[model samples]
Target: MTNHTILEPLREDQWFIQSQELRSFLAKVSEISAHTVDDRTQTLARLEPYFQELLVQQEWLPQKFAQVNPESRMGGGIGQWLLYRAKNQSLSIFSLVIPPGSTTPVHDHLAWGLIGLYKGNQEETVYRRVDNGDAQGHAQLQITEVRRLKTGDIYRLLPPDGDIHAVKTTSQSASVSIHILGNDTGCIWRHQFMPESHSVKSFRSGYSNAPCEEEEEKEHALH
Candidate 1:
């Protein structure tokens, strides 16, 4: 467990700083971010091998980093445990846990993202929007790559440096990943593609654990 004294500076978000292991990971992120900021190539080059190693060697996160109850039907469907977020929305770090047979919609992040698979198996498919509409419109898509990621695997999606894809949890056990995105991912609206309609719409992919007015009201009622 991490010393409680170290968590005071990062109290705005939900995090299990008690885990010394997770704290070490966060420390590594901070160190890498300082040198790699705004440079996708640098970020990938420096962080890629680091996360790749983490996927292979590290195991275990605090209980709080997981679903409240492991067998509780995965209450929120997909679990995204927010750890730390920058005030300027420049970056956001969180853990995403997907239950077996579940998948995120085909979506694109306007900003860059780095995904590290911490546990279980993941299958992701990357797509490119191909539209005959004017020079600016994207109407259809072409599958670029289908990656099979196992625990200890890492990949980046830097609009210009990489591709966009949706992830599916193929393991019987839940799959967990650590996501570091360029901006406030939950607050910003991004594009979600509909292959069947050959269309795309702007939507926000909010995490399940984000605080909101509705949740506050429920808490106030109970109080």
Candidate 2:
């Protein structure tokens, strides 16, 4: 089967912004202001459907993100595209296409995030921040859970909800997802992937071997 076959088929009309669930989710996310864990969780739950709807509408996403390139300052990979950026509200929507044997670095966002799988299968491993040192030193992070996501799956990441995770495509085919987040300006603090020294290393260490060894090696040397 082709990579597109991995995606759940949908009617053209379904892509319209008519679903009550989606509308409600957008309303909640758009209005969320409180930074408390409880409040964030509630807002994320309501916004999950928006992520789902975007993923379901992938048929038109490429054209919308035609101007995006993975090598640009935004930093993404082949088949990955950014659809829109609302820097003023600290929100951005991204459509990722993961080629077979490809993987994203283990990273964390500055704010909460929502992910909806539209195409193929992906494996997600989440981490939790932990206090490992005195107040004068930095705390450590730990891997807490691992999940395998396929088409039609939706998940949230934030303060209360799990947010720190690493993802990998399941096969040679592409896996697509819609990412909604609170920060779009690219000014937020991004957690760098410290694979060799991080507290959470085992969860994503062996899942998928790197496909571009030469490029990865060059990047590693630069780091």
Candidate 3:
């Protein structure tokens, strides 16, 4: 039961475009994170309000990044679009788009994060790992909570706590959520679980718009 796959850091910070809203939010996050390096809980607590503010401003996120990917890695037309990423790979922000009636695989983000509903509604089923994770590809998950999220609703992801979860778009339209995480979530090899089978597998849900490595950066437009 490995925690996550290790990967090299990006050579430089990547910003999809020059958006003042996102730039300011990133600045605030960096400031708060730098001061709260020793405590992840404090970091999330202090940043929630800022994250909330960002989520409510619907215009901040471009429509292009909010669209579902036909060739999605997460399948079922789920789109994970990267908005910004740090050079060190310690932080990232992205938008997750899940089409109507689609559910994400039960997954765990190794790093702490804040996720907020931006558009449409969703049903989130949160799980907890009861086993020690000593057996490879094996895991025992217990459902801890299930939530219905509306626009502006937010949740925290602090590992071993509110970490493992699956989200389904309950609304008629596709649901879009903003994710601010402590790691390169989409690029890193994280765990995706199958609760019915009590199994786990390593997967990398790469961004629909951005490539993982620096060499491929040229393929996408930069502004």
Candidate 4:
């Protein structure tokens, strides 16, 4: 099995600054509070434009980045690479490569998030956390819904909708996704996804897969 090389560079900042579409997204996002049930539906609506913009600007994302099967050793498992960050507020962009026959463990976000699919197809299983801890010390996690997303699609996950889900990539290639979240100078916590174990945990750690040490060091100094 040969490693599938990314022929194109992962372009960031192509869609960072505020645009007409981004402004519209922000409007919808402003309507929902992190503390309310409306946050789920509103956030998804707001995220659609960003995803659309990314697809329009970089059409090759979905066509070129397909999910690879781990068995074939052609593609790797789900991993993240942070693209950019700023003072006060930070932007984190990551690519989630899901190999065929491999799925992400169910998890939820500690902060607001937006996801867009660049290539292939994926099945998302949404879950809700139940507060009633069973006698076995395992918390009750419920599967609420399942959604199938294809290339050039986008969505949002928030705490209000109980945004815990498992993603399974379609066959033929690896499924790649671009995720964006706000990280306030490492003040915001990160939500970790555990697919096999079906759990998510929160942490206040710095970006693990940031672009480079020198760049990260500079950013840290400014913060």
RMSD of each: 7.5, 12.4, 3.1, 9.6
Cα lDDT, model 3, residue 52: 88
Task: Write the residue-wise lDDT of candidate 2 on 1-223 in tens digits.
Answer: 1111011212221121234544454555566634444676776766665556656654544343323234533234434453444424355555666656667766665567777887789998887777653433243667888888888798887753476667887855667776676654133334444545643321111101121223446788999
Quote the RMSD, in angstroms, for model 4.
9.6
Candidate 1 collision pairs? 2-18, 55-152
Worst 10 residues of 1 by lDDT: 1-10
Flag regions of model 2 displaced more than 4 Å: 1-38, 63-80, 87-89, 132-139, 185-187, 199-223
Candidate 2, residue 41: lDDT: 72
Writing each residue's lDDT as its tens digit, candidate 1 over 63-134 gives: 466542233222336777766676555667777888887887787766766888888899998887767545
Q: Give candidate 3 regions above 4 Å deviation.
A: 1-4, 214-223
* Residue pairs in clash, model 3: none
Q: List the residue pairs that clash in candidate 2.
A: 90-182, 100-172
Better model by lDDT: candidate 1 vs candidate 3: 3
The superposed Cα distance between candidate 2 and the true structure at residue 185, in angstroms, equals 6.4
Per-prediction TM-score to the true structure, in the order listed: 0.76, 0.62, 0.94, 0.59
Worst 10 residues of 2 by lDDT: 202-211
Q: Which number leads on TM-score?
A: 3
Lowest lDDT 10-residue stretch of candidate 4? 1-10
Task: Please report how far candidate 3 places residue 198 from its true position, in Å.
Answer: 0.6
Worst 10 residues of 3 by lDDT: 214-223
Candidate 4 TM-score versus the reference: 0.59
TM-score of 1: 0.76
